[model samples]
Structures are given as structure tokens and as C-alpha cells.
Target: MARDIADDGVIDGLRAAATADFETARAMPPEVYTSDRFLALESEHIFSKEWYCVGRSSALPAPGDYLTCDLAGQPIMVIRDNDGNLRAQSNVCLHRMSTLLQGRGNAGRIVCPYHAWTYNLDGSLRGAPAMSRNSGFCKDSYRLPQVRCEEWLGWAFVSLNPDAQPVASRLGALEQMIAGYDMTRYSEAFFEEHVWDTNWKVLAENFMESYHLPVCHAGTIGGLSKLDEMICPPGHDAFNYHTILKDESLRIACAHPSNDRLSGDDRRMTYLIAIYPSLLITLTPGYFWYLSLLPKGPGQVHIRFGGGMSDDFKGDADAAENFRQLKALLDDVNIEDRGCTEKVFRGLSSPLAQAGHLSHLERPNYDFARYLLDRIETGQGAV
Candidate 1:
């Protein structure tokens, strides 16, 4: 039998750490990452109730374009309807409970592979083969269950909970803070999915803080980092962020000449934003990238990684080459992060593993732990 999360003393440790000041705060207990019971609690109270980022709206620009994902064990799809509106609906067919769509592509209508049951782009039941003899059948009575989906700054978010708060309202401050970037104009260059052998939170924390950059990323962007220039401010209820000014040598990371909105230090600044539960974004003046995380279980994470160039740089003579180099550099950074996070998970499983004091740079990690605890303990719906 699995150990109960509440009785294993992990909650007590997290509670204490969550409430501590930065000077005294410690890393979360190891069991929080290694316990099946705790993962179950997170699945129920956190993942199921929060707004999860699906990706940029541009990825499904045309009618009939759609993408599928499993949110907290519920299979859902975000599709562009015939009217060019994005809609979230249960991907399961109503008749035999079979998945109606796989992976992602353009579809005039949802057609079930198990049977010939079909649905319109709006999710209305269009037809059911050989059902005319069934006296009780009513095609008008059935429709795919709708899920809450909203667009904020061109990114699409979906939630299973009907009563979940609107994402834009909670993130108004964030939008204002990044208004100059005009994130909606940044086009996605690539999007890929991968699974790593590590707890989701571990990778999230790694992204939240850059304290390990000098050592772990020495072969890549580490040399360009100026530790003293990095800023870690108090996070809000909805998100946490830190900014770092890029070195001049990495010209594409700095604002393009055409961008008049940013001046002085802002030209080279990069913001690492963590929108609670699981979206991490690195917004730079010339480009942007993000990771949308989902836990596979106690020991593995599913990652939706995508990024693109800012519109300001699109007219530059060297724009294509600059983006190519930037993507290659980012790939190298991910390789280092994968190795580090997987090692952390392995260490967490040892009997001698223990939490350690956090650095000032890790303030975001501390704030994230508190967010998790608040939701897991009180069942708070959304940020």
C-alpha cells in the first residue's frame, strides 16, 4: 500500500517551509516529489482546477485546426471552429467513449476511429451511422462537453473546472508589466513535446531560479551572465518573475533597432516569468520561449516547449541567422537542465536526502512552494 501524504510528515515540512522568510526558507521535502499519494492530491486540487496553457493561438490559426492534450487525466482538445473561434471540448466520443481525435491536424469535423460517429467543428453531433432504427436516438440531444478556454495575449488556456476564474483578470498586472514587449506579435518558430525522467516541480524550480547557471550552463549562456545584475523581486499571487540584462555580444537578445518602446537597460533585459501551477516563459526583447509542464506521475514530466522571434527583429537583415543561432543555444541549455533536474530527482529518492537552505536567487522557488501548499491544503480554485 502507498503511504498517505498527510501522515508522512511531508505536508508539515512544506507548511513550515512555505511560511518562512527567505533568510530561513528551505527547499521542499523530498517526499513531495517522490510520493504517489501527494501527486494524486496535486492532480485533484491543482491541475484539475487551474488554467493550463495550451500554446499560442497562432498554432491553430485557421478553422478546423486543433490540438489535443490530457489535462489531469481528462482528454481535451482545443480546436478552431468554422467561425475561427477557439473552443475547448471533451475529446471523447459520447456513443462508445472512444477518443475522437489523435495528435493534431486540420479536420473538417471530428470523426471517431472506433465508429463512424461524427461531430461538427462546433462539437454538435452531425451523424451516427445506422442509428435510424433506434427509436430512442435523438441526434439533437448530444454534444461534446465544453471546457472553459480563454485567450490572453494570443496564448490559449484551458481548464476543466467550470467555475475557474478568468485568466486575463488574474494576469492583468503581468500584461501591463510586459506591454512594451507586445508578446502577441511574437510568432512561434517551433513547438515540440518531450518527456523527461524527473518530477515536474523539480524542472519548474530549475526554470524559476538561475542560481545554477554559472556551473550547470557553463558551456552555453553562463559566460554571458552577470550575477550581480540579476533581479529577483517579490512574486504576486498569480505569478513570479526575475529579470537579467543580456550581454551585448548576444545582439539578438537585445531589442532590435526598430523597437522604440524600450530604452537603456530595458533594451537588453530578459524576463523569466512563472505563471503558477505550470507555465514558464522567457520573454526577451527580440524573442520568446516557453514550457508548459504536466506531470506523468511521481517521477516523470511531460513538456510542451515552443518559442519564436519577436516581430521587431523580423525586418533585420540577419534575422534568420540570428534566430537559428538562438534556437541552437536554447537547445543546449535544455540539455544541461535535463541532466541537472534528472539528477536532483535521483538524489531525492535516496534515504539520506534532506532539504537545504535556499539562496536569495531562489525566491521564486519559495513562492511556488507556498502556491502549491495553499492549493493542495485549502482546495483554492485558481490563482
Candidate 2:
């Protein structure tokens, strides 16, 4: 009498909607955006099993600097240990299961505010005050469970699955494609968290295709875009990308004068890369910004937003001014996208909402739907 989380009808509809060829592809089923059951499937299959990007590596420059994230309902922490290694471990206390940290800051040891149980920076139990009274209390037996953590380019990623493939191995092609940009040298200038009332995919799709730029971002960078200049290629297994040539007027979007690696259109090109399961980056020649997404439920998404200028601009006298202007523009762009994506979620909730035909510009969206179906279907088989 229980409802099936992986409804056969919905799976069939999703498969039909996710065809690779744009000529035959359609929008994903509305239930994909509206069903709590489907979100549960995604959490189990995609979020938990796949590598989730936390943020840039440069953010944790010194030992003891740490950040905490709630990934698929599992509270995890990433810290720079005394050995200069980035480690990810369970953030919950082993003794009473209390969360050990709040927001990000430097800590010599993780101390549970509840009972004063403490852990070293490397997650080994440092002390359990007065615990020797108990017969079975052994400090050697207690350490926060370690999670898989990796640094790809400059981003920090963590996966809950022990056997998950290495992040660098999965993203080799992406690295080669972006080699000229030297993304690792780009520093993190700012990071922020926000919750929006929209399905995560809606915002992701909005980012994948700039088809809505002229309308949704009309007040900001929209007018600078040209549909003909946009290129949405078929996605790879781990990621997808589209490129647009920045208008000459937006100088900061183009390569800095000292950047000699890129030539021709590549110098002015901006690559929109969506690393599956939820890291979306806008990599321009001189600057980059990204959104790492986590779903709150079917109706809302939590976003980690950050960006900074390329190292090529580090010595330029105008670099600071350029970044300030760029940040302001991006903030305005985010406001526009929120309004548009939130409205789409509202429409998707309607009884009359139906899957529609795809525009060639929306090829990445179609590919994303296929990625979702593949992960969820394969996960169902495992279960």
C-alpha cells in the first residue's frame, strides 16, 4: 500500500524526456521538481554517493582552519590539520552524538559543548573528561569517522561513499579543457550562503544555459550576451559545459593584459561548467565564480556562492576596482536569477504544468535530466 519512490511511470517519462538529441528531447517530468520522494532518491543516489564540492582550497590557508557542511543530512567537517593536509570527517561527537562545530573558524581541538568531549584537529579523540570511570572507555577506540576528501584544481570536494572514484580522475577532461585559464591560481575573495525557494535543478539549469540571459538578467549582464555566440556541447559523464564570448566592453570578463596563454576567441570566452551533482562555475579569463548547491527539499535549495579574480590580474593597478565592479554585477545577476528560477518552481507545482519541447539552447538541461535519471535508476537497481 506504500507509494513507490521510483515510480515506473515517472522513470519512463524521465527517460523519454532526456533523449540526447535535441530534436527529440523534451523537458523533464514536473514531478522531478515537485516530489519529496524523488528528492529522497536524489539524496541517496546522487548527493550521498557522488563527490560534493565544499569550496575553494585557498579558504583554509592555515592549519586548524575549518568549515562545516551538512551534506545529504550528514554533518561533515573539512579541516586543515597540523600536517598541512585537508581532512574530512564526521562533525558529530562520537560520545553523545552532538554536533562539534557551528560555522567555520580556527580551532585547536573540536570540543563538544554538551559534555566537553574533545577531538584533535585530525579527528582522533583528544580527551573525554572523567571518562576513565567507565570500564569500556578507551580513547584509542574513539575517533571521528573519516570521509573521502580530495582537492581538484583549487576546489575542495568530499564524498560520503568510501569507494567513490577520485575527483581528479573524473575531471581530467575538464582540467585539460580549462588548462589555459589556470583555475587553480585564482583565489577566493568572498564566500556566502543563501537559501532560495526553488528546486536545485531549476537554478542549475538556469546556469547551464544562457538562453534566458537577455530576459532574466536584463537589468545587468543580459544585453551583453548573443545567442549565436553561445555553444552548448554534449556533456561528459562527470560534467557539462557551454561557452560564450564576452562582449569587448566587459573588459574584466576578458583575459588580463598579462595573460599570454590564451589567444583569439579563447581570450574572451567564458566557460560555464556544471560539475555534476552540483558544482556550477562561471570561469571567465580574468575572473571566476561558482555555486555549490544542496537541496533543502523539493521546494528549496541551499547555495554556497563565491568567486574571485585570476592571478594574471594580481599585479594590475586596476585589479581591485575591477573585482569590486564584477562582484556588484554578479550580485545583481543573482537577484535576477532568483526571481526567474523561483517563478519556474511555482509553475512546475501547478496541476496544468506539463513537460514542453526543448530549444536547442537547452541541451545542457536535457543532459542534466539524463544524468539525474541515470544516477537514480542505477541507485534503485543497487537497492
Candidate 3:
């Protein structure tokens, strides 16, 4: 059984250790944001332990359906057997730890090329091609080790820890908050990833603040938000999650003539939600975008972006085209953001760089730093 995350003392200690005062600085301590050891701690405690969005349930639409992914250095396979239940298992073959699958595909059973060890689509040992009877190995008892798996809002999440809490409990209020919108009805139209030469924290902190708009992202997002009304939301002050509203200028630009679903309140604002650890969900009138920051090393991170159209627009040709256009615009925003991130990473390591102050409107960045440090310092989410 997975441990109860809600009552875990470690999580409580993490929340309590947050330093409200430390967040006022220009940046986190040099080691906290740049050390290799610190980065590894996060991988173990944060990425490996938590429920990470690995793919969409739609990716495995039938029995014998499976997808392979490497998350936090662990190779995992997610499958929905013929009966339609989802299961996650180590992609490593029990026989020699060799990877069972290379990528996504349909397979009635996974067989290890090295040893002929085979596992059913549900991850049970189905056979061992040539093991002699005297070898004394029981196929029925040697099934692939199963990992915890769950689905929320069409996204499939898997936890390396076999005893982690259910996806619903870990997600808390996020489901209800987005319940009115159905993500399962949508389809992925765009996927792209790039290496960011900075600590994962740097990128996450950047997303939490709108202050960079007038400068860093000025060419792309600045004109869309009013310089003054772009203040950070107060929601970051608590353990509370945040979603930002897009200004009217950007809202109008995102809604194309092909998209009829952009009318009403949905067209009025852009929504940004920061899920703890490393998941970011952004909702626009025409589509929803998810960004996952997977740490590659001390000063490098893999950023993957997934874009999907609104459920209502999935079948409409014109609406789909508008969503594709929206994705292109988002890609532009990502490029603009990455350009600034590269420069910032260089500065963080320079002797000339000193800690800076937080503007009133950039308080969300403060909250993020505070939470990150708390998790690191206490070893609660240490990799």
C-alpha cells in the first residue's frame, strides 16, 4: 500500500520549514540552485517520488497498448491490457535489467531479447522460452515489478514509488477546478522539447512571475499584458496553486475566427497553473498546454511541451487549424523565454552577479523560491 501523503510528517515538515523572509532576495543561494548534489536530491525526493504526468490515456486506447518513457532516470512502460485497465511497470526486464521496450507500440506481450523472458501486456510473466525445468524458476512468480499508476484529466501519471498516494489525493483540488473542461476529448497536435542550460528552478521561477514581460519577453508577451495590471497573484502566498489570467490584448489575439469556443469568459483570459515539484498546466480558450521540467544534470534540464486542442474543437477542421496556430504562437513564447534563460544561467555563475530584490508584483517568484528551498533543506523531496 502507498503511504498517506496527506498525513506524511515529511511533507508537513517541508511546508513548515519554508522561510518567508529568505524569499525577498534576488535569487536562491548559489549552491541551492547550482550544486550537482542538490540537483540529485531533488531527483530522488521530488521527481521520483511524486506522481508525474507521463502521457495521455488516449495514447493507450486499447488492450495490448503501451508506451515507454524515461522519467527521473527510470525507464517505465505504461499499458492498458485487453480488459482496459492501466498498469505501469519497470521497462527493465527481470532477467537482466535490459529495457523491455524502446518506445510506444502495440504489443500483446513484451519479450526480453537478451533472455527470451516474456511478460503479458498486463506485466505478468507469460513465459521463459527455454529455461530448463531443473532451473527451478517459476514464471508465475516472476512478473515485472509494478509501479503505481493513475489517470487524471486525461493525463497518465506514474510514480516510481510503489507506495505513493493515489493520484486524486496528490492532486487535491486541481480536478474540480478544471472539471468543467474535458481534456480527454482533445488530441495532441504539437510536441517539442529543448535543453535549457540552467537549473530547473530558474525556469520554474521565471514562469511564476510576470515582471519579466516588460523586459525578457517584451517582444512576444509584453504587448499582450498591460505593464501595470500584470501584478503577480496573491495565491502564491500560501501552499496554494496559482493560475494567471491572460490580459484582454493577448486573449483577443489567441481567439481566431476558426475557433467558435473562444466566446464568453473563456476568451477573456489565459490561465496558468503551477503544480508542485515540476508540472505546469496552461489553459487558453482553444487549447491546453502542459510543460514538464525534467532535470538532466546540475545545470541542465529537459523541457518538454505538450499541446492539445479543446475537446469541442477536436472534430472541427477549422477549429483544429486555429488550435495549431495557437500552438505555433506558444512555441514562439517558449523560444523567447529560453533565450532569456540561457543568458540568466551564465549570469548566475558569474562573480559579478549578486542577489536581487523582489518587486511587489513578482511575489510569486518569491513563493516558488521559498518552497523550493524548504523542500531542499529538509530533504523532504531530496533526489
Candidate 3 lDDT over 250-342, as tens digits, reads 532344445554466555455666666677777655567777777877678787678777655555657656665777778788888888876
lDDT of 2 at 160: 97
- Candidate 3: lDDT over CA atoms? 0.68
lDDT of 1 by residue, 170-220 (tens): 899999999988898899999999999999999999999989989999999
lDDT of 2 at 43: 91
Give the TM-score comparing model 3 with the true structure, all chains together: 0.83
Off by over 4 Å in 1: 1-8, 380-383
Q: Any idea what lDDT model 1 has?
A: 0.91
Give model 2's TM-score versus the native structure: 0.97
Cα deviation at 227, candidate 2, in Å, is 0.3
The list of candidate 3 runs beyond 4 A from truth reads 1-18, 22-25, 179-185, 234-266, 315-317, 377-383
Q: Give the C-alpha miss distance for residue 123 in model 2, angstroms.
A: 0.6
Compute each candidate's TM-score over C-alphas.
0.97, 0.97, 0.83
Show the lowest summed lDDT stretch of 10 residues, model 1: 1-10
